[model samples]
Target: MIVIQAKLIFLNQEDKQIVLDLMRRWSSCMKFAYKRLLEGYDRKTLKRDLQGMFDLNSRYVDDAIMKARSTLESARELGKSPKKVIFGGRDLFGKLQKRHINGKAYEKLKIRWQEKRKGNLYSRGDKSKKGNLNTRIEVRKNGTFLRINVGERKYVYARIEAGYKKNKRREELLQEIAESNIPYSVELKLKNGNIYAYFAIEEEYPEIKITKEKGVIGIDINAHPGNISWTEVDEKGNLISYGNMPMPELASGSKDKREYFRWQYAHEIIEIAKKKNKAIVIEELEIKDKGKRGDFSGRKSRRIRHSFSYKSLLSKIKTLAKREGIEVIEVNPSYTSIIGMLKYAPQYMITKDISAAYVIARRGLGLQEEIPDNYMKFLNALTVEELEELKEHVKKTVRNKHLKKKHLREINKAIKFLQSLESEPERVLKPLYGTSFSTYDFWRVLKVAVVTPLSPEKVPRDFSTLKELLIQGKWGDP
Candidate 1:
């Protein structure tokens, strides 16, 4: 179920007000229903009297009542405490947000839709509390142009490209379903003040493949843009691929653009899992950078940390995996990186980050702590010239391609360091190819992952003192 956002455009004030009225009524209905739910009123009781409680059409009233019940029920199942949901819930944008019209309503709202170019059908918040629920719109897709209905049709709606290509993904999904697939749900959203739509098309069911699985892929997320690290492993807990794939890095950009990059990166990781027919594993972090802000706090750091979008990444991967019938496992995130740093980094001559991924994969597989003794075979076999060439390969290929020029001086400094380590940087940082290629703090955090069981949350960002600690062999064999 992929959600697409489009700016719900309004051509006139009257139409906007009409939408506003419908949403207000919807909110009234939700309030009534939620109150009844709290009073121990069952769905039957609420549904029976919903139309009388709100000045809305019967279908709209039914949708509001049923959806409210559903919302409260789901919260209860998840052990969430009951809280009053405000009108146009902050997450739902507006009242019309939960309204779902069946095929009959769609037919009533549309005179005609050119399936090939676009479809003009009217909708309000379909039930969402995000973006801009500016007005109700009949979203069009993939059309050369949009034609506005100025009372020519029964409804006040704007024509748009059937598949708004701003989100090319929506276009693709719409195209895919144009044939014989059934859509599970279609949602309308007020996304960032723009009218957007989410199209969830159901695919044909396939034969069940796994009662149990052997292979697993583990992933670790970083706060910095494009700092995702992952590894693949076999059933025996043997590492299959460590730092073999391109790291997906979001460049410094707009929020929408950054979200899109993270999405594309998830797809790349999913592709690897699909190829291996393995389940996906990732650290199940409930909190991010909790209580870690410092005295020298800066706006940029705060924004970067806050906007990491870990939840979105997990959501995207899970949705994709579900359709493909793959399993996703979330392991405890605490100390996975430290364990990786100690156990797997040296074995594969990779950075602590990738080693963390390796450990995550192993933990999901229910494997023990031991690393394969011969894991270093590939690194040991590489000659000095090959090692230097590999170092340069990362400096140019991965580094130049993934790192943003905004941090060029810092990146160049790190690249120059990699160049200096011509023969063996592994003795210091894990294999440059695996981790430190993108991370600037190879000496500090990675070293902690190397020796200490789990570095204090307040480990100095500066590496000078940390470097001295590492040289003293205070932690691990490294």
Candidate 2:
């Protein structure tokens, strides 16, 4: 979607106040609807109640509820408590409550806070309304204008100016609005005593041109090293090329700067794919909130959680890929890291992250991964007696080395998988891919049992350290 920002010029104070009044009521209804939604009210019920409680009509009320619902969903996704969310600017609210600084400073802050709280309006597009009924934009012979519906058959007219600079995107959007019946959403905001209108229109994308039939470039986003690693593979699943893009400023920069860098990163990857004439493959990975308030998550966890915008970055990549007609493929993220570390990293002598990218690329090509013969033989040799001894070894290592809970869990899970296999020697575990290969559980057993403790972070970057273990079927010294 493309968004056009323009200044709204009102002819008279009365017309401006009419729009302002609707914005105030719309903001108020939004807060009320959010509270009711949190208190177990459905959208239908809240829509009816908001119309009665606020001055807004049905459509405005619906839009308010939509905005509030989106805010709530975002908060939940970030693992934030809804109760702690400040409707306006939280920092400004805190400053005002503290009563710090007097006179002009205080007044300026108060005005900004009030504007943030009550000076916003939103109206969704409706195709049946010829675009949008509440806030409609039309280009006439004289100039472009906006007709805003404030109340019962009451309307306010304002001139809209998109500025003097040349903007091809804006011009294209305007042409689309004038030529097609496609709906466009509008949002009005009062910024610094001036009214700004944001118009959003969806853009059509071309058909897929570059596809996996030729090759695929797989991407792996790593947090510890703060780099995006990519590996290109041929149609036969052979590695062709690989590289890493370091993003040192991604975690510590300002929000705007970080977002700009993300766009640049996406552009770089897409350009590489275009150059190679290959499709792009990335894991469909979802990074949920690291922890809640007062959870005392570690510094690394917090930094990674706040710094990386996985969804945003992935969306940007996919959007740009669509515009470039490059096919983008998303594969299951499960065990990509483990499979990469165990199977590909040692064999290819590459970093774990790059190895993971290789696995992602190969998976996109519809290839099945087979367990190494040596590793399979080791699993087959493990009896309940041997598993018990390994369990004792893991427990001793954990107690002596003071390993974290996660390490213990990993080792224990692997041991359990080994125990399950003792009963069924010829057992085959099938995953969602519906292949006759062993499940990730079997791999995890090998990882903890034989691959030098097999933790992604703890394992040596030179995966050759574990080469002897994998080749000789000898368990690592825990």
Candidate 3:
């Protein structure tokens, strides 16, 4: 049995209430089932010895009895008497049989439960929240519904049901989650700024994969004046072809909305290439220097900057590649964009033409070999007439160097702040200092001071903000 966890985000008060009620009822059912098991005439004490069993052993009826007895003795030593011991339902019990199985089963069951609960809740109410109700349930085919109780409160129960019939919808959601590379865990936590029978599916890590591969492909993300520059290579480290793709009409913001469509196109291309069992090579990008301004002055520049999800795009490519057993590698992007332009002349005029260059460079590198120096030099010298074009290209290449430097400085400052926080032990700053402090403690420290500081709350959020700031800064410090 596998338990998969999911989150259910309710839209309105009514929906929220319905979900809460369902969760409580489900918990009560589990409690009821546990009580039944306790009262059975099996000639064994369920409460006396069950608690002493290891989690796995206690999952079984007979073993639970033995464990309870042992636990009772231990409790006596601490001046406490063992009380009623409740067992989880079949699904929960099966989950406890093994750690890995328990986790997976929990998720599957959670997703399924949330999905079913959503339908039931929606049927009862007309008005909901801003977004559609998102439900996550775990699925385990053989698991039976059960309930458990603790003291006067009954909790932890589930209703078994058939799988959802919407294969396409499920697949689409799964794809979205996968592409986002978001690994989440279901946590029973507060919702809507209040404590309730709500579960939070929190993202554990940024769904991004950074790899070091021999070949490098340059990419210039665009919304207006759309274009991409690419350079391909063969196994012998020889440039095969280089070019760019232009979005001529994009300069006026008409093509701004096409970014998602472009991603879809790129995704399709990658998918087809995957079928041929090929590896993808791309540039390694770090958006550290993005906070600095750029040439695009007005709101249009801001919109263009906001529109590109380069990280997400790269993330999708890596994820799809991994699923298909194709390798995705990143090489120093450095000056790939500029170099691509110089190498592929007529091809560099537009962005779309870059795809041809990408194929050539990918082939030339043939899984091993650094991007050649000549290409880098060519890129360094390549010039663009449009300030937006220059800024975008430079932002992709030179800006990385700035980010790399700032990141190191931030780390040093963060260490001091963390040590101070740790030294003042009784400050009750745990909430202020999140659980995963080590990952982004420095940024968190910065955020406490500013309402909307230059830095963002998280890495991805920061990246987006920084891009805009950088582009905006290009006009003036304001």
Candidate 4:
């Protein structure tokens, strides 16, 4: 959607007062609708009652309800209670409550607060209603004017003074509005003693042409390290290029500034895809609430988990890719990093992040992964009794650290994979490698038995030393 804002010039004080009164009534209706929605009222039921309950017409009431519903949904997404929300401005409300200022300053604050509390009017677009029903724009020879239906066949007119020069999006929208029966939503807002009209129109996304026929760029977003790693692969599944970019701004910045960086990075990534004539591939990362009220995950871990906006960055990438007509492929995120660490990292002498990107690219092209022979042999070297010993050792570490229950499940999974490898290796191998012994199972077991004991806090980024350990079949002193 594209939004264009324009300043409204009232013809006289009477028209301005009429607009203000309408805004006040509209905002009050919105608050009423929001309260009803919170009390289990549906849209149709509220739509029927709001027209009769409020002094406004049906169209205005509907728009108020729509705006209220949007605000309520936003509150819910942030895990905030709608009842606790202050409609105007929470900061201004607090200041006024505390009586922080006096005389002219206090009067100014109160007016601003009133404007925020009662300064919104919205009109949804309709093709049948000539772009908009209640609020329609007429571009006349004298000047552009807005015709707003107040109520009972009464209307108020205001002149529009918005520049569209040099703005291709807005220029195109004006042309579309004039030539075709295109619908555009309008929101008239009163801010700082002036009226502004925001016009929003849906844009058609271009058709996707760039695809995996050439190859793909696999992206690995590492939240803990605050960097994004990517690997380019050819159609034949061979690595062409690989790189990493750090995002220190994401760690500390204003919300708008951080959003700017996100878009900048997204554009850069898509430009690479465009230059390579390839599709973009990334993990379909899903953030789950694994931390409970009494979990021993620690504050540092929770901060790292919450501070990073994994979905936000990924969303920006996908949105930009769509706009640029680049195809995007999302693969299962499970074990991509671990697979990269055990197999690709050591073999290719690359960092874990880049290796994971390589794996993602391969997966995008429908390529299957095979475990290395050394990793297979390393798993074969461990007996059932030794596997049991490693399991017990992992349990001891978890218990000593007071980790969550999920860690206990992970220890069990690793031990079971090893037990299967020690007994009927073919059972675990057939699905992954189509062979008698599952090679992939060995790496996971190796992670628990070998890697965890050496570095309990986190996985090492550099896996150069892992090559020798896997080759020599060293289960080490765990």
Which candidate gets the maximum TM-score versus the true structure?
Answer: 2
Output the better candidate (1/4) by lDDT.
4
Off by over 4 Å in 3: 1-184, 187-220, 227-231, 241-263, 275-277, 291-305, 343-478
lDDT of 2 by residue, 1-478 (tens): 9888988889899899989988999999999888888887999988888887887789999999999999988777556787778988889999999998699999999999999999999999998878888998877776678889898898898877775464556655665695586888999998888888998877789999999999999998887678899999999999989999998877786899989999999999999999999999987645433554544264433654555786678789999999999999988766888889888888888988999999999998888788887777666665656556655655656543535455666766766665554445364332223333356777777677655344333566777766766777665355
lDDT of 3 by residue, 1-478 (tens): 1123223334346644544554344333333334444455232444334334321122232323333334444443323323433232335444445545546666765554443322221111011321111222333343322121211233344432213332344434433543343432222322333322222223333433322243344334444445545454434444544444554433444445655555564676465443433446654533322223433333433443354554555566655556555556665543343333222322233332363345335433543223233322322222222222323333454345755344434434534454555543431223244433342342333322221123322222112332222233221122
State each model's CA lDDT, in order: 0.51, 0.80, 0.37, 0.78
Predicted structure with the largest lDDT when compared to the true one: 2
Candidate 1 total steric clashes: 31
Per lDDT, what order, best first?
Answer: 2, 4, 1, 3
Model 3 TM-score relative to the real fold: 0.34
Instruction: Please report, as a residue range, the 10-residue window in candidate 1 with the lowest summed lDDT.
Output: 111-120
Give the per-residue Cα lDDT of candidate 2 at 374. Answer: 73
> TM-score of the candidate numbered 4?
0.79
Better lDDT candidate (3, 4):
4
> Each model's TM-score?
0.50, 0.85, 0.34, 0.79
- Report lDDT (Cα) of residue 161, candidate 3: 25
